[model samples]
Target: MGENLHEIWLKDALVFLFAAGVLVPLMRRVGIPSVLGFLLAGLALGPFGMGALAERWPLLEHLTFADPVAAEPFAELGVLFLLFLLGTELSFEKLWSLRRMVFGAGGLQAMASVIAITAIVALVGAESHAALAIGLALALSSTAIVMQTLTEEKRAAGPVGRAALSVLLFQDMLVAPILILIGFLAQGQEANLFGALLEALVQGGVAVAVILLFGRFVLKDAFRMAARAGGRDFLMGLTLLVIVGGAVFTAAAGLSLALGAFLAGLLLGETEFKHQAEVDLEPFKGLLLGLFFMTVGIGLDLATIWSELGLVVAGLVMLLAVKAIIATVACRAFGVAAGHAIETAFLLAPASEFAFVVVTTATAVNVLDAPTATLVTGIAGLSMLLTPAMAHFGRRLAASVDKRAAGEAVAETFPDLRGHVVIAGFGRVGRTIARILDAEDADIVALERNPVIVARERKAGRKVYLGDASRPEILAQAGVAGASMFIVTVDDAKDAAAMVHAVRRMRSDLPVLARAQDAEHASLLYEAEAEFVIPDAVEAGLQLAGRALAEFGYSNEVLKDRIAVERSVEYQRAAAPPA
Candidate 1:
């Protein structure tokens, strides 16, 4: 039995990886977002597809997902990583800055969505408790999809993205109470639901306080100790420990595991280790998040969807309409721009992965019947599957509005920047590059779209303009046409690629030294005509190897020559087709 389980796991991993490795790039190349690709992959792996075949076809047994339930853990981790990354982006200072949006827009969106959906469900003759459970489950948007999309598109740190995130954060925080409410609604359960709620509150509060205290004190020092040990493995293990430990702790408190992981990230974001931690966890986050989306696909039932087509269609349309209305108004009230509010609404209208957990748990607790739970879950799944397209349409619709509102129509001027360096994005990496160049008295012009960041940097006397780096008009305004060099330092791969192409078109001979996220991204940038690409992973590896070799008594010249040879070989290997 153990050997069979192991074989099944191995086979499933290979299939999932193969799908991601092939389908993701294809989707990305064709301008379809990864969220949809993952969903499609999951559908192919599900019982209605491959799993059904595995039962009858001997030849294809090893290529199918034998047990869909086994993928759930990986899917859950993907969500935890999303929350963790979200938490890391939010420092206490940033959180304080967005307090109004968090409490105001977030609060209103959740309440309004729940109330509107509940009323609609009740009007359809459902029980009040079941209606409430269904409403709560469907009201939430897919955080994993939305966050991944926003982050990849360079919108997560933008106003619309932040507003959407604030609402999602509130939804995450509400999971515990909803679970307790489900317990109360449970049919034949004599358990003291309110008592259990109180118990949860007490335990949760205690657990949170302990985690905060420990992270604020012991964890930082522990991270330092781990770093002092000078082993990436140790640091990586500690990172996993922190994230998983928080998840376990939160689950123990009757809250969703994602809540605790978010808390841990929030705490760790305050530490110096945040950047390295992010680097180490990023690959896992991407792969696991893809797996999470695929599991979402597995949850869907094609036959049920076909049989209840009208109900499914109606449920999805109603949910989207209600959520968009609620979220748009909420965002506006919280001071988001009109176009941004609409974009935020669309980005968050799809039902979340948590909806599955909610519906399943509710059915198990007798708060909802199995059929009702399954139907609602189906609605949630379909809504999620359509999210990428909805987001794309919303973004296009808002583009003109955002442009007119921001007034990019009028011609713009820049400081004397003929032969100056063009720095796109004013985030951490860009800032570091600016500092280095500034110390050497290298003239630089930076392009950034975040109004707040631009305003703050301008106040600090930096030559930063409020503009999207991917736009030709913006690039022209920033004097990229005659700039001596272009440094594409944007953290987003898609944006970086666009920036590279834009720069290459304007100045084919100019050196465009771009920061590639990883090897794959480096290849994309290279294809985009970037003059030089330095992948972050490759650079880090070189640095570590150089230091280790020097410590092992190699002469400076020998180390330099050896490292250069390694760099040359790596680039050559990268240029070669895979065997």
Candidate 2:
């Protein structure tokens, strides 16, 4: 029996791995988000899909998830890893910096969404408790889905991303109290609801404090020791240990496991080993998160949805509309820009995985009927599947709004900006160059894709515009034609090269300086007609060598000559035709 059980598990694992490793990539190549691809894969391979026909054709069993619920625990781990990875990207300081938004915007979004949803459900004739329960469940958005989409779009650090994350963070915090409230409702006035909620709040607070303090004080030292003692293998093990250990600790306190993992990520993000941890654990995060998305698809009972098609559609539409309006209002009230608020609203309007948990618990405790729970779960699952499409649409809409505003500003500001420096990307390298030019009283125009950076820089009186510099229109609008120099400091190799190509098409003789990832990228930029290309690897080596010579007290002239010779040799090698 044990051997057979292992075989069943292995079969399911094999199917999922194939989806993650093969099917997802194919979807990505054609412009589909991996999250949606995994969802479709799960739906097709699930019991409702091919599994329903498996008994008649026994061979089909090997390809389908005969027992989808068996994968739920692993799916939950996927959520933890997703949140943990997101946490690593965000430091405690950055999180702290957003405290006002986290609490203000996040809190308002959740409360308003719940109230609006609850009213809608109640008006549709659900009992007060059932309506409240449904409202609470759907009030939250899927952190896994939203964060994954933002990460894929490279917007996780932008204003819209930050706004959505703020709301999601508060939703995670509400998990404990919301579950407690459901239990109180289940007791039918036999228990004190306020007392129960307060107790839960206190317990959660204590648990969080302990985890944060321990992580703040000991996590860095522990990671450093692991690196010193065990190298990469040990560091990887330690990362898993920390993530799982933190998750378990929080789960023990009746809090969300993802919360603990997020805390662990925040703590470790502050340590110097952050980049290494990110590289080491990214594969695990991706595979597991894919599994989680697939399970969501599996849970989508197509038959049930079809049977209650009208009601399901109504519920899904109502849930999305109500939440979107409320979230948008909440964000705007907190001073988020109209574009960002709208994007965040759409991204978060979908119901979360917590809805399934809440509905299941409510049904089990008799607070909600099984039929209602099933319907709610179906709606939630369908909503999650729509997340990727909604996010994509929201991003495009937001970009359009931002670009329109940028266009108006350019018309007003760029008429006489001649001989200026047009810098692509307002990131570290671009900013440094802009500062040097500013110090010299030179005119400058900068273009960047990140809304948050544009907002911040614009507030600080910089001439930063929100648009991708790789596009010829954005380049032309930025006055690249009239500028004396064009600098490409965008991090993505493809984007940097595209900027060079775009500029060359417009002004072949423009002095274009670009930052490249390595020798090959430098060669590509040089071929793209960039007048100057600085490969990071080559520059770092030259700087290291220069420091060494300086430390040895070499004469200034000798050091300069040695650096010049090395730079010339490296540049020539980089520009040479590939062998």
Candidate 3:
């Protein structure tokens, strides 16, 4: 009987791994978010679909093996690692730079959502404690799903993306306090509120102190030693040790493990070893995180969902609508323009994985009952499922809003700015270049596909022509024939190469400078007869190397020589005939 059980467990594990391997790539090819794909896979194999697999497969079920209720530690670990990576990507300086958006917009959204939802819950006859818990849970927007979707869409560095990130960062920071509050509410003690608050503060203070002292001072050196040992397994083990140990410590102090993992990430993020840690942990993080999302799918009870379909749908709509309104209002309050405010709101109107963490924690501590927790989790998950569609609609809404505002302006003819640099795709790179050229007193005209960005640029005194660059008619409209240079800085490599080709064909003697995201892209631009092809990654590496050398006491002259030598070698290789 034991042997049969072991065989069943092994088969379940194999089926899960196999399904994930197939579905993720298939989803990518079909232009769906991989998270959605994982969820769909789970649902298909779950009781809702074929139901061939066990209602609760043993091996997969082991992920949620805690006593009181099943707790998927590994799946939770995925959330931890995802947060860690996000924290590592964000530096203190960057956070400080976007303080207004990160704090003002994010803070307003969080507070407003909490208050509004709490009020709604109270109106619906829930107790104050449960209402607060539900409100906090609903306040979160999934950083993992939203960010991943944005990244896949190649908009992770755009205006909407940055705004979404800012709001998510604030939510992450707020999760720590929310976790403590949930713990207090769980105790259900009638002690002084102030005393409970004081206890929470002391516990939080100790956790922070330990993380700062031990994490920064001790863990860095420990990891350095492990890295130097040249044992891959040892380094991997150590990475796990730090994550699990930090989480265990924080959990013991009555805080969320995800918060502890985030803190651990921040600590490592500050060290010289951050990139190495990122590279080493990436595989484990990706696989485990996918598994985590899959478990969320598996844990979803189809029977309950069927029985409460209308309630679930109604709850999902209400939750998303409330979040969107709150976020939109908050963005406006922060002085973001109307169109951008709407986009920002829609992009962040879904409940985050952190919501699940909060809800699960609240339920564990008796702040919420099982059905309520399930309802909240299911709604949150559904919200995440709808995010891609929400984002697409948001962009469309922003576009329509922008067009309505520009009703008269669209008919106005732009001045013929000749002998100036014509920039295609006024995105991050294009806008930056435009700013520099404007500073240098060089006349410039920017062509952007996104009308929202074009409008913003025009409002900022930039002469942006709203059009696609790949088309010859648009290029002609921008005076590309007479321009001194054509700068192709679009995110799409194929588009950049096409623009280069069109420009070269139109005017063989005209110079075209193209920005490529990598070496392969640079080669494509080069083949298109671009006068200059700047590979962003190569330039970034050069800059990093120069900074490192300078920090190590190298003189400017030495650093210049080192850079020149590296460039010369690269140039020679580029100039070499194809093998």
Candidate 4:
């Protein structure tokens, strides 16, 4: 039996590697996210896909997930690792900062989604208790898929991603209580909702407190000891022990293993080993997440979906639409911009991986029947299938909404601002520019999109305003008419070009100096009327070469002449915009 298990494991690993090795890269080359590739691979390889083929063709047995049940443990590990990686990116300070959004936007999003979905299901003839269970189940958006997809898009730190993470954190915390509530709902006349909630709160509190305390006291020392005792192998073993142990301990406390792992990761993030730990766990995380996605696809139950095709389609549509509207409304209520709010809503519209768990728990407790559970599970899987497509549409829609908002915005008043420099993007580059100009006593009005950063800079007595600089209204408010120069230090070259273009349109003679991400971007900025475009790579390379020349005992005059010649003859002429 052990040998058979090992043999099966070997075969499954090969299939997984095949997907990652061949399927994922092929998808990427065609402009598809790897998340979708994993999902599609799972669906095609699972019982509902090629597994169906294997039943007819014995030769195809090796190509499919012949036993998807065996994949669950690895899939669970995938989710835990993914959360742990996410936790490493976050610190407690960041978590505290996100508290308002977590409770305000996230809590409200879940509550509204549950209430709306329950009412709709009840109206559609489901029993009130069952509707409530199902509604709560469907309210959750997939943390794994959402995080994975957004991270792939390189937006994990962007506005929409941060907002989504806040809501996802709240949803993760709610999982334990919701499971308890499902149990209570199942009991019908004998159920004690308050009692269940109290117990859940107590258990959750104890688990969290224990994790926090141990993280503060024991975890670091243990890791330090392990590292000192051996090396990478020891460190990796310790890492696995902590991840798996945390999951076990919390699951024993009646919470999800993924939650425990996430908390463990959150604590570990504060330590010195955070980056190393992330690097060590990432390969495992990717494979496990792929397996988890495949397992979800395996649960699609094609027979049930095919038979109730109309009803299934209706369920999916209602599920995604209801969640999207509720989430969007909740986000808007919390002062999130229309574009970000709508984008977050669409990204989170799908049902979570935990929906199946909820249905299974509810059914086990007799709150819901087998048929209903099957239908909801199928719908949840189907909705997840739409995650990548929804994300693409959401991004385009968000850009449109933001562009419109920027165009319509009434610029904030900055009275008595004249002959100053307008620094468009108050990030690292913008901050440096402001400091240099301030040293020269050059009056400046810095415009930044992130309000938090603006507040921080403003607190430090810098001139910063919260607004997109691409808008003409914003440039005028920043004293563009009287300003000596326009400094477009925004990170994205496209944005820098827009800022340059906006300033040039208002004042054709204003010197537009911009930072470019690359040569191509520099050309674009030049085309947009930037008088001088600094390509980061070019300047960095020159600085490095100058330092190397100095180290090699080259004279200062020679270095200067070579640098000037290279700038004029080699790099700049190649990258320069047309005359």
lDDT scores for all predictions? 0.83, 0.87, 0.76, 0.85
Candidate 3 lDDT over 320-415, as tens digits, reads: 899999999888787676677788789798887777778889988888999888888888777776787888899899877755544433334343
Candidate 2: RMSD to truth = 4.0
The TM-score measured for candidate 1 stands at: 0.72
Residue runs of model 4 more than 4 Å from their true location after superposition: 1-6, 410-418, 441-483, 498-507, 527-529, 545-579
Q: How well does candidate 2 score on lDDT at residue 434?
A: 89
Residue 31: error of model 2 in Å? 3.3
| Candidate number of the best lDDT | 2
List the pairs of residues colliding in candidate 1: none
Displacement of the residue 400 alpha carbon in candidate 3, Å = 5.3
* TM-scores, one per candidate: 0.72, 0.85, 0.73, 0.90
Q: How many backbone clashes can be found in candidate 1? A: 0
- lDDT tens digits by residue: candidate 4, 1-579: 999989888898788788878987898899878888888888888888888888689877798875788889989899889888888888999889888889999999999999999999999999999999989889999989998898877888777888999999889878888988887785666777887778877887898899899999998998899989978999899888888888887887777787788888999999998989999988889888988887877788888899999999999999988888889998889877788899999999999988998999999988999999999999999999899999888888877776565444425456346788888888888888877777898888888776557668879987777677887877777778888888888778777778888888899998888888767788888889788878887788888999999999999999999998877764465357755
Tell how far residue 70 is off in model 1, in angstroms.
1.3
lDDT of 3 at 578: 39
lDDT of 1 by residue, 289-341 (tens): 99999988988887788888999899999999889889999998877867778
Backbone clash pairs for candidate 4 read none
lDDT of 2: 0.87
lDDT head-to-head 2 vs 4, winner: 2
Arrange candidates, best TM-score first. 4, 2, 3, 1
